[model samples]
Target: MDQKLPTIKEIAKRLNISVSTVSRALHNHPRIGLRTKMQVQKLAEELHYEPNTLAISFKQKKWFTIGVILPELNEQFFSQAISGIEDVATAQNYTVLIGQSHDSMERERMLVEAFRKHRVDGIVLSMAKNTDDYQHLEVLDKYNIPLVYFDRIPKGGQALSVSSNIRSGAEQAVRYLLEKGHKRIALLKGPDSLIASAQRQEGYTSALKQHGLQLDPDLIKEIDLSPEGTRAALTQLLALPQRPTAILCFNDYVCFDAIQAARQAKIRINKDISFVSFANLPICNFLDVPPLASVEQHPYRQGQLAAEMLLDIVEKRKTITDIKPVILDTELRIF
Candidate 1:
């Protein structure tokens, strides 16, 4: 029969010291004295003893884990983002806990409270589309849990954040259309409550004004970020008295629906109507007709930066004041 592994109690008995002293020595507690710590560590190594993480965490009142709250994990962009987050967390020897809010404020609030109850060291969050109240986020602040927002950030929050420059991306997309001789451009925007949508709208208007063009409210349509919504919005925009020669969609998914709607309306892409959008999805290449241009937002880098920021706060290596909003640049991939 194989010999059973020696426990901390066995080691204590062998050394004729109390279990508490052995545990403290294993942890390298300064109060335990260097000589005693060295002796206990040496003996524990000889016995092939492994300390339980749960016990150590309980003793130190730390979970050494961070929570990630996202609207949904089904998209490829977020999948890549999660991969980047895992890369940083693994390097830092920390664990990650994930929660999907599915774009619901109630779900998001519940997840935040759950993370608080679990006593996670920090959090990385991408706010839900319908989230208007941030009082639940205050719970994290009250508990001294640092938070780093990424991608879809809150309008006003005490948390640090990392995100792509959406305004620049939107401007680039609009500029590409204008350069292609596309006048009377239409914008299929996301919900008004979303910060990302607001930034994109600002960029669109700024680009138009720079070109000495009057902003036309009729050419802009705000819709939910979904395929059905995109389809309906495109129909409405096309049915206007003066239809736009080109359209800039809120995202790749909206672009897909816009293209489909144009084809259904017997409009030739890049000829009768040009299209540009954010999110350079790989599937765009396989389409029968692709948008004239798309924006690369670097979701992977956003995730990595957000994770690093959270870990820094957790390790006490930096504070929120020391961290600034990290905005990565975007590029217009013109087809």
Candidate 2:
């Protein structure tokens, strides 16, 4: 390979300063000294040091900047989550660097690497839909930077996590439907790649078992989330010999599609079929006729807790591995 570009480790070594000092100076952090920042900048310019060229940080010196990477920013759930994260970061006098992965694992990895290269104090991440491998995340460990996962986390508890008690939320919703006299309840399952969705599937089965309802595999459909896909799933569910009286959707977005399809099929929502969804986004409250109920996932709370856990470790006030997970409980919203 061609001569490798200069890195922060080399720059810090040459300047006789900590990597965090170099990172803070480069980013013009307020806590850094004027003379130190100028010196670090001069040395960085001379070395042509780019963020991507760095892979290290200073001991006992934090840059006070956090990186937040999530699946998509446009969605209401992610947007609300970001607000919670920002609230916590602002209170702590820390800057947040946000990146959207758009549910692409490659994009998520790139963002994580970029954050690492910039020497972020820590990262708060909600993994992408296709993030089946997590070898890339090991870089944070090598560098000793902390990370906290929320919402859609990876397998094996690789990092501190904050999320809604998803299984309990699903169980609560299913039990509520049963109380409403819905025996043949259909489920629209999300992709298996998401841990939260998988947990919800298990909760659905557990609720059925708890209530002595026989498991009906045919009543469960994997939702591609496309309009066509939602329509097809609904069509199949309605055509069953004993059509379901209620449907449990993966999320509010899927429930919205189900409502539209149910209406197109001339089924009056409350009269002909009942529905329940997860993730109580604000959009659902604005619906003219909301689903009979939805499980309040508290995405904002998840984000808040995720940021808090990462900051605790980043500031060395707590150890991530030793910290207990912050699991936010859900509420059932009946419309």
Each candidate's clash count? 0, 1
Regions of candidate 1 where Cα sits further than 4 Å from its true position = 1-6, 9-48
lDDT of 1 by residue, 33-57 (tens): 8888988999999999987778878
Candidate 2 lDDT over 234-279, as tens digits, reads 9999999999999999888889999999999999996799999988
lDDT at position 312, candidate 1: 87
Query: Each candidate: what lDDT?
Result: 0.87, 0.87
Candidate 2 wrongly placed segments (more than 4 Å): 1-60
TM-score, every prediction? 0.88, 0.80
- The TM-score, computed over Cα atoms with residue i paired to residue i, of candidate 2 is 0.80
